[model samples]
Target: MKKTLIVVCTLFTFGATAGTEDSGNELSYEHFVHSDKPIKCLYGYAAEKVGDHDAAIAIFEDCIARWESVYAMIWLAQIYDTGIGVPQNLEKAAALLKRGAHTQDEAGYSSLAKYHYGILLLEGRGVPVNKQAGIEWLQRAADEGVDEAKDYLQSMP
Candidate 1:
């Protein structure tokens, strides 16, 4: 019994150390993008899934800088809106979403923009309170296939 216990503890300690070492070698978002194009999106999304918001945001920012795609803006807006990897700054999030909205054909910010903007309007966080304008933007997003906008419109009365 004593030998069995010692072996178990030794294996556990080794596994823990290995896990720590692996984590220390984890890549940042910026690195992920330049490291492998084929896996950038997947790696970024996976990092976010693991709660490394800063890394994910950095990766997305790099992607946006390089590609100028709305997808990166949308993700960045999400991070800012939720305060995932940084402080929650609705104004910055709104601005990014707006920029993305302009660049994207019709599906730029989607539900994220509408939902967060709607919440901001309700709370008057970043922009002035303009329920009407908020509703209009939300409707646009919904029409563009933002599911949250559809629900928002329904609740707007």
Candidate 2:
């Protein structure tokens, strides 16, 4: 019984210490995005998932510079909006989202940017509050099969 108690206490101490250590460094983006893989943005996603927001921001910025990736713009906008590893800059976030929305519309991709941008506009998060413009943007996103935008529009009497 004494041996069992010692072992349990040791295990508990180790577990608590390990939990306090920064484990984010253990998760490498290289593990997720291989050089041979066509999708390089996965590295940014992996970095963000591992709580390495600075790395994620750099990776996303690189991807955007190289490919003008609309998804990267949206992700970067979110980072700026939430102040994740950086100061909160709503205007920058709004600009990034606007660029993403335009790129998505031009590329005929999903309307995720539109949905986010519409919400920002509606709430005056980073721009002038314009319900009409916000509704129009949301309507466009809804037409493109964004269920959240559809639901939001429905909720608005």
Candidate 3:
């Protein structure tokens, strides 16, 4: 009886500890708040990962308002496009992506934004179908070394 109890306790302890162990990729809210890294963007991502789209939206909006953060704009555009926790607004998504694509930055947000915008333009998912503009945007993304854009352009007939 005692042996079984000990084994059960040990299993419980191990399970609990395993559950608490960090996955290494998760960004905690405390870290976002305390670290020097941009809090709005990090916190927004964290919130979005946890299925808190409302909080993510607010946080991303705050980031955009403060710094025109491309990450925030892209996330917001995705959320709007997907209608996650909000009404679907393709026009809004297209506008946000366009703004992000136009914003100058060294962190490659412009490339990412252009890639997504190009896809939307190509597929007519959010914006009107404009194959020429889409190809141009994809070419720009390819020039910026976006591998997906390169692959997509090559795959085109």
- Weakest ten-residue segment in model 2 by summed lDDT: 15-24
- The residue-by-residue lDDT of candidate 3 on 1-157, one tens digit each, is 2432454455345432222233333344322322224543655665676687776787788778877889789888989999988999999999999999899776678888999999999999878999999999999999998899999999999
Tens-digit lDDT track of model 2 for 1-157: 2432454455345432222223343245533232222254545655675587876887688767777877778888988999988999999999988888777434443388888999999999999998998999899999998888999999997
Angstrom error of the Cα, residue 2, model 3: value is: 49
How displaced is residue 103 in candidate 1, in Å? 2.1
- In terms of lDDT, the best-performing candidate is 3
lDDT of 1 by residue, 29-120 (tens): 34464543433533455457568776777667776777664656766776787887789987887777766655643434444555556666
Model 1 worst lDDT run, 10 consecutive residues = 15-24
| TM-scores of the models, in the order given | 0.65, 0.74, 0.76
Counting only residues 3 or more apart in sequence or on different chains, how many pairs clash (N, Cα, C under 3 Å) in candidate 3?
A: 0
What lDDT is reached at residue 78 by model 1?
A: 69
By lDDT, the candidates rank as 3, 2, 1
